[model samples]
Every structure is written in structure tokens, then in C-alpha cells.
Target: MTSSPSQRLAWPDVAKGISILGVVLLHITLTVPESKDTWLAAFNVWLDPLRLPLFFLVSGFFAQKVFRFSFAELFTRRLWYFLVPYVVWMLVEQQTKRVEYHWVFGDPVFDFSQMTASLLVGHSMAWFLHSLILFNLFLWCVRKLPGWAALALSFSPILFIAWQAQFTSIAKAIMFLPVFVAAACFRDAISAFASAIEAPFKGEWDYRSFWAYSGMVGAYAIGFFIRRTWDSYAGAVEVTWLLPGTEALVRDDVHILVRMVEQFFEVPVGIAVAVAVSYIPVLSTGLRFIGSHTLPIYLGHPIGLTVLYGYPMALNPREVSLAGQWPLENTWFWLSMCFVYCAIASLVLWALGKVPVVGWTLKPPPIGASRRTTEPPSAGLSLSQKLTETRNATTRK
Candidate 1:
């Protein structure tokens, strides 16, 4: 029996859902004072390799379609999809920070200088949006070049930055661009592999399923060990065998070099885990819902965490620290806080997306300026409806 189109799409959505959840968990683990040094923090570290890289890889998986659009269409879509949100959210984040600063310090001072700097360089968490816009433009500009040459050109800066340990948002974008481009280039191969993995499960456990399952476990295990070692070393080590006279180089430089090497292995492991996890229907279904609205969840989760934790910390850092130290002593409590923040953020965004004008903050605007129809916004669609529409569109194409 053949798998339905919806079934085929589920894994990618699941993968994305997992990635976004990891991102949210990572932020929570890092942001909450209580969670520091707990097992939750260690879990977050383990998840670090899978989080953003998987997100970018998935984005890349869809890039082939975007690459086909005309310049006008591309501009319109990207503007609505990335740039507009980036600008709007950056302003919102900065304004929130300004207010937070004042409330915490008992001084109503707006730091124009810092805001101006953020504008020039991408704002805090909003950098991902800024980077996405730039990556699209960069890829388009080099579209005429031979594929290998284009990839090489795109990768050069990333290598330089990685070696130097200079990790600005722009550098991070450059680092991840190759993954995105590779996905666009090899979408068919990936799709086919996913299909092969799913084929056996449609009937009964077979050799293919066994190998697929084993591969998934093996990849995840390798990734886990890699992350553990990377953390153990703090990305700094002497490699006299790898490079002669490298002892002269500073620990930071060696750390960056080790990180660069670790990523080369880690990203593929993330992709493998994503593909492997997709075969499980129940897990996929739950994650698919979260994956579908990742944009809003991504933008809103930090705000939710900030509101929950940041205010109290700002008001009385020492008091908040002492209070957090106790509850966080329980590992389960720390883990639950991560889930709670993510759930709260998702709910808040979902609620905001239901409103008319306010929904624009969470969902992409309609493609053209003219709103000729009284139809509801796309955000209102159920998961099944969205998946069906996607399948129909893929079939039509």
C-alpha cells in the first residue's frame, strides 16, 4: 500500500516541530535563572546541535520552490514573510527592552544609541529574520553562477568566520546558507529517502525499517556523543597532530576550529534524527501542529519567558535568584518550566493570530495589497486543512 500525501509530509513537519521545540527549550533553559546548571540545562546543550540547524535545513528543503519565483514574486513574498516581520518585531523587542530597563532601574531613559546599533546590526532574537532575508537575496544574486562555484563563494566567508571565532548574526547566516542551498539542490534525494523509510512501516517490519530505525538511533547516539565531547572540551584543545605548531594559537581560536569540525558532523546527525523520527505517526502528529506555526512560536516564546522571569529578576535579582535556587533544585520542576513557557508562548501567539489586525504580527500578510475577499486569514486553518492544501498545491505543481 502506498502512503498518502499527508502521511509523506508529516515527517518534515514533525522534524520542524521537534526543532522549534528544541529552540524553545534551549531559550528557556538559558533564560531562566532557576534552570542554570540543572539537568534541563544539560539536555538543552545536547539539543543545541539539532535545533537551529534542523530549522535551517528544513527551510532549505523548501527553498527550491522559492528559487523558482520571479524577482517580483520573490520580493513580495520575502518582504511579507521575513523582512516586514523582522522590522516590526525588532522595534517591538527594542521598545520592550527600553521599558524593562526603565522599570528595573527606576529611570525612564530610552537608549537611542543601543537601538540605533541594533538597527544597523540585527536586533536580539530577530536576527534570524534579518539573516533569512539576506540569505535569500545572496542566493538569488548568485543564481547564475555554476552550482559548485556558488556554493563555494557562499561558504568562504563562513569558513573564515568559523576559524576566527567571530559569530555575528550575519556570520551565522553565512554559516547556514550552504545547508539551505544543499537542501534546495537535493530535495528529491531527501524526499526519496524519507519515502523508502516510510515504505516498510506501511506494511510490516522489514529489513528497510530495521536499517532505518538503526540508522536513526546510531545517528542520534553519534550526535549525542559529539555534543558531549564538544561541551567537555569547551571547543578548545591542543591538536598537535591535526595542525603543526598550533600550540601558538590561542585557546579561543582552537575552540572555534573544534566547533567548526563538530558542526560538520552534528548537522547531518540532526537531519538523520529528523528523518528517523518522522516514521512514528503519533509523535509526528503532535509535533506537526507545533511545526506549522513555528514562526509565531519562535517570535513569541522569548517574550513569554521574559514576562514570566525577566520582570522579577529585574525587580530584585538577588531575591529572584534565591527563590529560583530552591524550586529549580528539583530536576522535574526545571523541565516543567521549559514546557510551561513554550505552551504559554504558543497559546499567546495562537490567540493573537485569531484577531484581525493583530494577527498580522504572527501570520504573513496576504500577498497583494488588495483584500478583495472576506475570507478568513490562513492562520485560522486547522492542521489537517493546511496539510491538505499543501498536498493539493504540490499535486498541482
Candidate 2:
């Protein structure tokens, strides 16, 4: 039996929500110097393998819809959707940082050259948006290739990035490209798998709980070990060494090898986690809501972090010391701070979206300038119906 579109989409939305929360926690832990060396830090490390990879996978899942578009349609859509926001936000982030720096140091600091370079390379979290545009463009170019060949071409940069580790922007885009492409290429397979497992849970409580809890436990256990193995190797390389050039090469090789190994497990683990979480009705609903608004939250969260934590620390360390104290030593506090930041950021972006032209910075145009005769499917429609509707809508354009 076919599941409703809401049911089919729930897992992906939950996965995205989980991933974005991970992103927020990571940023919080890293930004708050006091939060370092705590359990939250360790948790973030353990979660690293699952976070962005899962995100990229979901992005690719949706990109399948875009792939149906003609080149001109796809190009224009991506430009408006990804590139415009990226450029606008890059400028906003840069100016915000400059102002913060001037406030803290009592001297104006602005570097047009450095800003330009950073924009070209995607210097910060903004890199995700920039890289996403590139990924879509690259996928568009390779759409006509044979499946295996297309995947191979998309994933070719993983080795180079693993060895060099310096081509931050391009390397990251390439590293995650395979996941995205896999989603596009195997979209049917993924949906089938989700449907198969979710279908059995219709009324069977024992079966549903067993799979949900087991998958969650198994994925986390395997994911943790994979990350630990990578960490140990990374540590060994840092402490033990050969000749200078040889040592660097060895370290890079080990890092790349471990990363590849970790990713092998990470991808499945992430999917399992998403599936498991989706079984919890309450949590699933909350995550799906967050996932739906990911674009705004992703764009705006960093600003909230900067203004609330980063700027205060930079501008007046003493004044903010008390506020930052609790998060430093308490894991609960740290987690709370992360959630609080995410909430504020999401709310701020939501408010911005309510405004007229200002809202455009956080919202993208509709996927395609397509017309539809029938009303779009409600949340109750089946996945297959929704996909058919999407195709029909695009074809009409």
C-alpha cells in the first residue's frame, strides 16, 4: 500500500531538522570557548559524521525534482534560489563582522580584497549555499551521462580534497556531491525502502518498536565507533611522525582513508536514525515543522549566534562572562543554549519573512514558474501522487 505524501516526507523532514539542530549545537559548542572539552563537545564530534552528509542527502532527494526541469529553467531557478540569498547574506555577514570588530577593537576594519576572496571561496557557513548552487549546476551538466559514470564524475574530487584538505569550499562541495547524486540517481530505491519499513508499522506495535529502537541503537553504536577510529588515527598522526614531507603525506592519507570508511557507515546510520525518529509522533511533527523552514533557519541562525554569543564575547568579555559561565561546565546548559539560539534565529528569520522586500533575502521563488490546473495535493496525498503532480506542474511551464 502506498503511504501518504506527508508520511513519506516525514522522515526526510525529521532528518533535516535533526541535522540543522546538530549544526546549531556544533556552532554553539565551537563559538562558546568555555563549552570546549565538555561532553557537549564530544557529542558534537560523534554527530559530525551524520550531520552534513544527511543534509546533503535530503537536498539531493529534493534535487531530483529540479532535474526534471530544462537547463534554462534549472539554471534560473538555482540562481534565484541559492545564489541570490548567498550573495545577499555574504554581504550581510561580512558587514556584521566588520562592525563587531570595529566595536571590539575601537578601529574600523574592512578588507574588500579579503571579503571578495572569501565570497569567491565561500568563507563560512555561507559556503553551504554557495556550494549547493555549484552542486546543482554540476548535476545539471552530468544529467545525461550513464548512472555510474555520472556518480563517478560527481565524486571524483573526494580523493583530492582528502589529500589537500585546503580547498575548503570546492572540496566540501565535492565531498558531499556523491550523497546528493546518489539521492537523485536512486530516488526510487530510497522511497521504496522507506515505504517498505513504514508500511509494516501500520498496526503492528511490536514490529514497529523493535525496528525503530533497534535501528536507532545500531546506527548510533556503529557511527560512534567509526568516528572513534578516525579520531584515534588522527591523534596518532598528530603525535607520531616520520620525516616532515612524509609525515604530512601519511597523515593526509590516513585522514582521507578514515573519512571514507566513516562515511560508508555514516550514510546508512543517518538514514536509520531519521527513520527511527520518525516513528515518534510528537518528535516527528516538531522536526518536520523545523525541516520545512530550514532555509530561513539555516540562513538566519548564524546571525543570532553572532549577535548573542560571539559579539558579546568579542566586544566585552567581562560583561558576558557571567552569562557564558553556565554553558561552560554544564552539558544541559550548553544544550539549552544551542536550542535557544536556534529558536531565536528561526523566529527572527520568520519575522523577516513577514516583511515585504526584506523577506526575499530569506525566501526563494517557487521551484519553477509552472502553472497547475488542479489544486496542489493536500498533506494527505500519496507520495506517488505528489511526484506526479510536481512533474505535471513543471511540464506545464
Candidate 3:
């Protein structure tokens, strides 16, 4: 059932909040070898299964309209939403890469032709947005197909794994297409399931305890175990499926069993995370706020990350493994810095988006969009408006 206008579907935002925050933190720590052994790293690793899966899942949930939208409608509402940032940020980041490449690799090397080609082929640092474009386009193309046929066709990309190897470039579109399609197609069922989980927590103390502890903690513990032993599990189960052909065909690194296990865990892990977020009223609201502004953080954080190269990130070479060292190697402080960085990027861009010319860097001009097209279903709410509503809800509460 659709939520009432007065009520919000809180979990999507919270899940997105968790995913985006983890993504930024993961990017920040990408160069640090010691970080891999930290508890914060484990926390990030535990979230690995939830990270992209949940992002693509909730994105497809929100994009259920694409299944029915006309091509024009798709372009205005969805395509524009992703393409703007994908193109604009990739362009911006390319500039950063020019300087960064010189610093890291001992001389600058970037081809403009390659940049344009990569953009056309959906390759960029903003890969999430790129994959979304491809996924949405696929949906639009398949919109006319019969239900079962469309559903069946969506699985075609999962077959691409047969061609991917640990050394080769991955097709992210194929890697994540099924998750996106599943969420878009099965959003109602998933939302209903999530709500059913949260319902217990909203009731009596006994029910709440059951959900808050037994339910969420149990899921987290399982996820923690799965993540901690992920390497061993993947290494242990290495069955390669070559296409129905000769030895020249591409190889699959880990078997289908690994993917099956990971995806099986994703559903419960995501639901548990959402339920936990909703039960914490104060924290949930804060996460929802962060989630709402994900576009800003998603676009701007990469630039912030690239800009911080020489400062927080220091390179230390070892014979066996090249490692990155942080000046102040405190895990808690590093974790705290990640949050502050995301928060600052979101806020600064949020404010700059109101500035005429400068705003283009963050939010693109909604091309081919009418005024109504520009006004999304939510039409967006300001922070002050949300605060006002909270204050006014006191009597109702």
C-alpha cells in the first residue's frame, strides 16, 4: 500500500544514509593498508553486502515509475537526474585526475578522447549513476514486454559474470542489473516485508525487545560472520563456469555459490538495518535527512577525496604490498572524520546550489523538463519546513 501523504517511508532513506556514508568512508580509506585491519574497516566490510545492493535496491524502488514512464518522461525525470551529475562530476573529476595522476604516477596522462568515449560507454568514477542510466534505459526498452518476459530478460546481465575475471575490467551494469530490476519489480513486496519487520518494534515493550535485539542483532551477527570470513569462503569455493564453448572463453573467478550466499544474506541484512534505523527516532531522522541529500554527497565527495590526496593520505611502500599511512592513525578519529567530510560536502553543496552560476556544478539544468517535470513527486522539502512540521506535530504527538 502507498504511504499516506502525512507519513514517509523512512527506511529507504535510512538505508541509503547507511550505504552512502559507508561508501565515502570506504573511498577515504582506500589507500590505507593498516585501515584494513581496523574495527572501522570491519564495520565497513560488514556493510559491503548492504552497500551497493541496498543503494541499487532502493534506487530501483524509487524508480518504479520508470516501468510505466514514456521515453520523454523517463528522460526528464530519471535520465536527467543521473546524467547531469554523472557527466558534470566526471568532467570535474577528470580535471582532478589530471593533477592527481601526475602526482601518483610521476607524470600526468589523460586523453580527452578516452574521457568522451568512457562517458558514452558508461565508465566513470560516478559508476553508480552510470549504471542507473543503463538500468533505467533497459527498463524503458522493456516496458512494453509481457511481465514474465521482462522479468526473465532482466537476468541476462547476470550471465556476464561468466566473462568477468579478477584481472579484467568488470561490467558494473551487468553485475548489479538483477538487484536493480528485482527491487524495481518487487518493491511492493519488499516494502511490505520491511514494514512487517518494523511493525513489531512499534508495538509493546516485549515485541519491541524481540525486534530491536533478537531480530536486528541476529541479522547483524550473521552478516558480521559472513563478511569476516568472506575471503576464505571465496577462496575455498572457486568453481569456474566457462561459456558453452572452447578454452578461449572468459573465466569466472569464484563460483555461483559465493554469489548465491551473498545475495541470500542481502535481503535480511537490509531489512534488519532499516528496522534498527526506524526504532532509533532521533538517529533515524538524522539519517533520513542525510539520505535525502545523497546527490550532493555522491557528487561532491569524490572531489573532496581527490583533493585530500597529499594531506590525510600518505604513501608508504613495502616490498610485498604498497600501503597508505594516515598521520594520526586512530580508527575512531578517522571514522569521525569521514562523517564530518560527508556532512561538510553535503552542506556546502546544498548552500552553493542556491547560487546562480555556481549551482550548475552540483545540480545540473534539468534539460527537456517542463516545470511540472522538474517538480518531482516529493517536490522536495526544505530543512526549515521539516523542522516546522516537527514542532507543529507536538500537539498531535
User: RMSD per prediction, one decimal?
Assistant: 7.0, 6.2, 6.9
Residue 240, candidate 2: alpha-carbon lDDT = 35
Mind giving the per-residue lDDT tens digits that candidate 1 earns over 1-397? Answer: 1235334466667778988888887777676555666776778777766677777778877766555556776677654678666777677767766667787876565777877788666757777777777777776777677667766776655334433333366456555767666666667766665665666556656675677657666665665566567667645454333433233555554444444445545665565566567666687667888888788787777776666656655766643342445563454454566568667866887888889988777666767532336445345589998888789889999
lDDT of 3 by residue, 164-235 (tens): 543122345544566777777777767766766766566635554455446545655665566456555533
CA lDDT of every candidate: 0.66, 0.71, 0.66
Q: Return the top candidate by lDDT.
A: 2
User: TM-score of every model?
Assistant: 0.75, 0.78, 0.76
Model 1 residue 127 lDDT score: 75
Candidate 2's residue-wise lDDT over 98-189, tens digit each?
77778787756787887888888788678888888878887888888776787888767644544345557645755577878888878887
Clashes of each: 1, 0, 0
Question: What lDDT score goes with residue 196 in model 3?
Answer: 61
Judge candidate 1 at residue 277 and give its lDDT.
Answer: 72
lDDT of 1 at 348: 80
Q: Model 3's lDDT to the true fold? A: 0.66
Candidate 3, residue 185: how far the Cα is off, in Å: 1.3
